[model samples]
Target: MAAAMESGELSEVCYPQDNTSCRAPKQPPGQAMVIYFLLSSISLITTALNLFVIFTISYFRQLHTPTNLLLLSLSVSDLLVGVFLMPVEIIYIEVCWLLGDVACTLYYVADYIITSASVANMVLISVDRYMAICKPLSYLYYITNKTVHVVVSLSWLCSMAYRLLLLHDHLRKPGRSNSCIGECVVVISKMAGIVDLVFTFVLPILVILVLYVNVFVAAMTQVRRMHSHVDAIQSLRMVKKRELKAARTLGIVVAVFLICFCPYYSPTVAGKETLVDAATAAFEIWLTHFNSCLNPIIYALFYPWFRKCIKLIVTLQIFKPGSRDAKII
Candidate 1:
């Protein structure tokens, strides 16, 4: 475990004893073991919940709305990561990517595809909400069923194209490339790195923020205009809650990208060798897994219906106890 952490597979922080100058908490083996246990649980729980969300939504026709469609897309992305990415991470923790190059490529591409698609979905959702709140008059036309399908399809297509470029340039080569034998296999090209950040992290985040900021501002303005909505106060408050929750979700996602991916890769992309060293590497992977792990918690907290559904599913009242599927509304 210490060896894995030291290899930058976890985060960039060294064990407290290794770097005396480090101000980080000294993780006792016992405490570290607990963290591992909790994180492992989180990975499994988040993944299962994400899959359930996707399955449940698909399992019910009444829940098929455009907004829910975007949510489904996000859930699918998380589901892929939880099933495909997290398990590999667990393996990497136990052993380096002993998988062959082809297998590694598949896993790497799967992670990239899902993560990139997640970013795109967030941006798409922000735009959807922005139009719904800011331009309600045309939202029905602007965000039609056909449009939703196109947008969602385009999101996946673009992410796939972006990843293929990375795969072609990076993963094709092994030891000579920026990546070690396995892992993300990020190539050692500054331009490629910059492009990746721009497309995957920077641009998506900027778009999400701009659209959601407009949405939030529009919501506030609309709220103020409801000066005499005395009978509608409860409904208006509910609207505000949903809008605020959406904004918070977007913010948390962008924050996760920055904290997890940007710092971890930026220094390496910039040829800062030590940043990819023991201390930072350990922190990066830990935070990266955390990004996938926290989405369900955020959804369960902010989404009332999701919370209720989770409760029902857990209690075995929503589906047969030993069944492979759920029946959530």
Candidate 2:
């Protein structure tokens, strides 16, 4: 029995001689297969959906609005989450990290950058919608394509910089948290975790909440104003209706973003240590990745252009000449 236990331990350890080595967590055959299928499905779905959005926005000239540009940035981040991060996570589920410590650090860095960009995109969307609904006349002047490009570029650059700062210790000394050979774990200090929670979750969410509330109020005011602007009442009503619909759609997106992200950060909110590992963090990690799959579905439900583009894409009609000028909207 003692020999059998020793053999099992040796199999799990990346380096048998090292006392301070990570042990790979094992799953039963049945559970492993189920998890493999579930995770792969999510990864594939996220990739495909986000890919569709990327192609649609990039190919169609008419879809190049400030709002769709923000969506394009978001879809790119979501695509990275699926194409790069999710597959590594799925592989990590079954075995020890055969990759070196540098790889481990890079993996975490990529994860942090992608997820941070996703959160930033959501905040941008909220701000865009607020501008469109609350200050329609000034929105065109203030929220032009050039400004949107700058905002999206800054969002990504900031996320990369912020995450680099946040994970500086791990990047500087990879495997600092690893006590075993096969383990890939990073323990964030309480102060750092709180800062992460604030920037990634709390602050962005508060911004979204505040902007959305104002958007709703403005939309309501537009609906209730029956006597103002007698000459342009009909045109004003049409514009307000369009803005209201957009606000509602974007509101749903923000709500889903919060739902998917909140639980992932609950431990921090509860003042618990933040530990990243295959075993403890898998559920939270996948829950957040699942949001990428949901975003395109939300677009399909709310945006007519997305549905039209999807049909063209599936039918391979997007391959034809002049498809860039296709009147999708």
Q: What RMSD, rounded to one decimal, does every model reach?
A: 8.1, 2.0
The lDDT values for all models are 0.65, 0.89
Models 1 onward score TM values of 0.75, 0.94
Question: In TM-score terms, which candidate is top?
Answer: 2
Best by lDDT: 2
Residue-level lDDT tens digits of model 1 in 1-329:
78976665334332333432222234577866786687678678878878877865665555566777888888888777777766666545533344555665666666677778988887887787788778866986878767888899999999998888776744565333323333334333566666776777777778877887787788778777776585768786666667567666656755665566665566645654322222226566556656766666677776666776667667877565533344333
lDDT of 1 at 43: 76
Among all windows of 10 consecutive residues in model 1, the one with the lowest summed lDDT is 14-23
For model 1, give the RMSD to the true fold: 8.1
The regions of model 1 sitting more than 4 angstroms off are: 1-39, 178-185, 228-245, 248-258, 268-280, 315-329
TM-score of 1: 0.75
Please, what are the lDDT tens digits per residue for candidate 2 over residues 1-329? 99999998787776777786666667999999999999999899999889989988998999999999999999999899889988999999988898988999899889989999999999999999998988877998899999999999999999999999999999999999887777788888888999999999999989999999999988887777845765668877877787788779878987998899887788888898789877788888888888888999999999988999888888999789998899986
